[model samples]
Target: MIVHDTPLNSYYASTSWIINITIRKDNWALTKTIQSLSFCTIPNDGFFEGIELIVTSSTTPSNGDKVVIHYYGRLAAKQGWRFDSTYDHKDQNGEPLPFEFVLGSGKVISGIESAVRSMKVGGIRRVVIPPSQGYQNTSQQPIPPNFFDRQRLFTTIFNPTRLANGEGSTLIFDIELVSLRRRRKL
Candidate 1:
């Protein structure tokens, strides 16, 4: 039984009609179930103009939380690359950043939220986001000017949650899940 239908639900329901899903894991965990239900099989060079995920998150995560995860493979066709350099703010003498931001409020890039919404509390997965879903035509720190045009940024955020306020950096996240609450229906 499907518990809650978040953005992922709508996305999969629409995309599934055009793709085939193959479940590789038989485990009956909630994460596995959701992934099995939403998994889509497309050729590596398929005409996917937007973001795609290997697995989708079952729990709804809020801002000001963090999640831990392991590294996985990543690739960007537009960039002609397969990986990005990892940086830990806290390791660089910068304070650990919070994962808090209003969903769909443009506080963070669309790619970050899209990736996070598809992740479970303890699940680790790789995400491929085109520049249009990411920084788009804008320039920011770490992301060089016009980088979006030359290449798409491929990041691996493990168990990503939201960040709290006063924390800088827009596109990337190193977070932990502190809580998951349903938003009241209007």
Candidate 2:
């Protein structure tokens, strides 16, 4: 665009200049989106694939309802342990127990509630819980030698299952939502 500031007079001189502008908002947004997605891709046969959701459920659970679940949790780090489980493994001496708790009741860890609330009956889901969500209170002093559960001895000798994770470690869980029911109102 050009503009003449001088009037149309023989004695008046007109000076016109050119100005160039570049608008890059769209390019900047696209670049940021691409950078973010780069961290979420999976390497499949030398090709990157987006994260996939596997769905196999019909009845979903909601907050304020009671839910029964079976879960197996393991630390994702190397030399990690199976910290918790409800799977019945005879050789492991584990008897699958149905864990029942009210949603949002705070009886269970934060991750469990978040996972359960999005789950359906008979559905299986794998979730990764960061340290912020589970066992954030690592500052609590370790249980004394006198304070121990019945299985502590067995775990000490044979397999260190149900291990206590270090503070800020990552935990991975395979949760199976068994059933859920609405709480009766008084």
Candidate 3:
């Protein structure tokens, strides 16, 4: 088989979509890979948040703490293209999916919860998640060398760009904790 890597940015730069996601922090074994990127250009203003998780920050979110977050994500590498916003999604009934959960509650994917637990409130980061902590055997990855079936990948609700099987896929997330308040121990 020929192993050829194509430039996804140059090819899938035209399509656009809006999406938002919430991620909770917890303990999880995440994978780091470069597969896709969210093309939702944040304003050039000072609001630009980098993809760096702060583990040493004080008062970090822990297990049993309810948290709120806002995020835009896509499959890692060439997998993340097109404008597929998860919030107030016009195509999906025009309502942004609300995300609030307790760390370590298994309410969200293990990869997401573990990633979120690594950040403090108001911190932004680009996290990469392995399939083990995510959908397990439920997700699919693109097949081989030329990884894009442009005609089908961008048009479907489930981006075809992110197709991982077997051991699972690694998901890339651009997450920011909007608010974090530990639930009162009553």
Model 1, C-alpha of 43: deviation from truth (Å): 18
Alpha-carbon RMSD of each model? 13.7, 22.9, 13.3
Candidate 2 off by > 4 Å: 1-54, 88-95, 138-167
Query: In order, what lDDT does every prediction score?
Result: 0.35, 0.47, 0.47
What is the C-alpha lDDT profile of model 3 across 1-186, one tens digit per residue?
A: 011122223333433222233334333334444334432222221112223543235457878888776555454434664322234222355444445677767657565676677677776666544444444332321111123533333333233454432323345566667667787889
lDDT of 2 by residue, 58-135 (tens): 777666898987766656442445655554322344444567788877667666676667666866555555544544
TM-scores for every candidate against the unseen true structure: 0.35, 0.52, 0.49
- Steric collisions counted per model: 17, 0, 23
Per-residue lDDT of model 1, residues 42-109, tens digit only: 12222112223343355755444433332222332223332332222233455332344444455554
**Model 1 ranges with Cα > 4 A deviation:** 1-58, 62-87, 91-98, 137-186
Better of 1 and 2 by TM-score: 2
